[model samples]
Each structure stands twice: as structure tokens, then as C-alpha cells.
Target: MRAVIQRTFETALFVDGEEISRIPSGLTVFLAVCRGDTEVQADYFARKVARLRVFRDENDKMNRSILDAGGEILLVSQFSLAGTLGKGSGNRPDFGHAELPERARELYERVRDKLREEGLTVKTGVFGAHMYIEQKQDGPLSFIFEC
Candidate 1:
């Protein structure tokens, strides 16, 4: 599994030109399930995302996890993250490494639910829908995780 995470003051998810979910202040996570990814990878990913200390603390140091910072999570599935670029590929994305949609959606939901079980509010985009995301990034901070 792979994820691109961003700290945001506000974030919203839109599909078919309709807003479906939003968060006040939290992390916007774009997640992808790669070929061979299993529940083990899902478990590791959820734990890491819950514990990642990207939020600033009292002294203005980046020492607080989202759990400590008190925020929600906007989880969006983005299979394209698993796409590969290389020679003889005609400059097109090769999704050969991305998990099939069925299993990928399962793992994506697992990650989302696990994060919620860790005590953070979690909102999600429609699984397979093309989504439009609007986010006011805090510190423009972003991080990537893979497992």
C-alpha cells in the first residue's frame, strides 16, 4: 500500500459535482493498494498513519500526531499511485503493479476503518469515483508512506 498525506486546515471531497464529505482540520490521504498488498500491509499502514507526528506542538515543533492534534481524516483511494513509468512504456502509466479494483477497495476500507478505530474521526471519498478535492494546506506539509 502507498499513501500521500497532507496536513490541511480544511478539506472537501466532491464527486459528480456534489460535495459528499469534508473535514475541518486534519490530514488528506490519497491511498493506493499495490499488487501483493495484504492485510498485513494494511495494518502497518494504518498504524503508521495514526502515529505519524507531523502536527506541531506547544513549542512549535512538529511533535504531535493527528491523534494528539485532534482532527479528522479524509481518505481517498487513488490507484494511480501504483502506476509505473519506464522505458518502452510509451510514456503511459503501467498499472501492472496496482491491485485489482475489488481487492484494492477492500484494503482501502480496512485502512479507513482502522484509522477510525484508533480514535480519530475519518471521512472517505466514494471508492472508485473520480473525485475533486479542495484543501487548504497547513504549512503545505506532505508526506509519503509505503508498505
Candidate 2:
């Protein structure tokens, strides 16, 4: 499993130019599942995402977590993250490492439901659709995680 986590002051997803989901002082997660990844990886990733110290605290230090700040979240599936880097080595990008869409969706749903149960406001982009994200980044902070 892999995810690109961006800390934003605010963010929103649009579908057909209509906002479908939005968040404040939270994270926008672009998630990708690998062919061999299990639900346990999804569970671990979600917990780490919630506790990641990407937000600045009262001391102006990168110490506060999303959970600490009562932040919201928006998750979007992106299989491209699993693209093998062969194209740079004179071959086309190989996406065979990516999990099938059907399984990815199931794992994503598991992550979403688990996070939601923790009392965070969680939103999501439509699966398998082109998504537009408007992000107001308070700190212009971003990170990547893989497991």
C-alpha cells in the first residue's frame, strides 16, 4: 500500500464541477494498493495517517497530528502510484504491480470505514473517476508513505 498525504488548510473534490467532498485543516490522501498488499497494511496505514505529525503545533513545530487537531480527511484512489519505474530504464511504465480495481476498492472501503469510526470527518472522491482537487495549503506540506 502507498499513499501521498498532503496537509492542507482546506481542500475539496469536484465532480462535474460540483463539490462532492471538502475538508478543513486536514489531509488529502491519494491512495494506491499493490497486488500483494493485505487489509492489515490498509489498517496500519490509516492509523499512521491519523497520527502523522504533519501539522504544526502551538510551538510552531511539526508536532501536532491530524487526530490531535481534530482534522478531517479526503481519500482518493490512484493506482498510478504503483507504476513500476521501468519506463525510465528504457521500458514503458508497468502497472502490473497495482492491485485490481475491485480489490483496491474493497481495501479502500475498509480504510474509510475504520477511520470514520474513529470520529473523523472523512470524505472520498468517486472511485475510478477523474478527480479535481482544490487545495488551500496552510503549510504547503506533503509526504509519502509506503508499506
Q: Which candidate achieves the best lDDT against the true structure?
A: 1
lDDT of 2 by residue, 37-63 (tens): 898998898888878888777888989
Writing each residue's lDDT as its tens digit, candidate 1 over 1-147 gives 888999999999999999999999989999999999999889889989999999999999999999999999999999899988888788799989999999999999999889989998999999999999899999999998888
Work out how many backbone clashes candidate 2 has. 0
Error (Å) of candidate 2 at residue 90 is 4.0
The local distance difference test score of each candidate is 0.93, 0.87
TM-score of each: 0.97, 0.92
- Runs of candidate 2 with Cα error greater than 4 angstroms are 87-91
Candidate 1 segments exceeding 4 Å error? none
RMSD of each: 0.8, 1.6
Model 1, 65: alpha-carbon shift in Å? 0.2
Cα-lDDT of candidate 1: 0.93
Pick by TM-score: which candidate is best?
A: 1
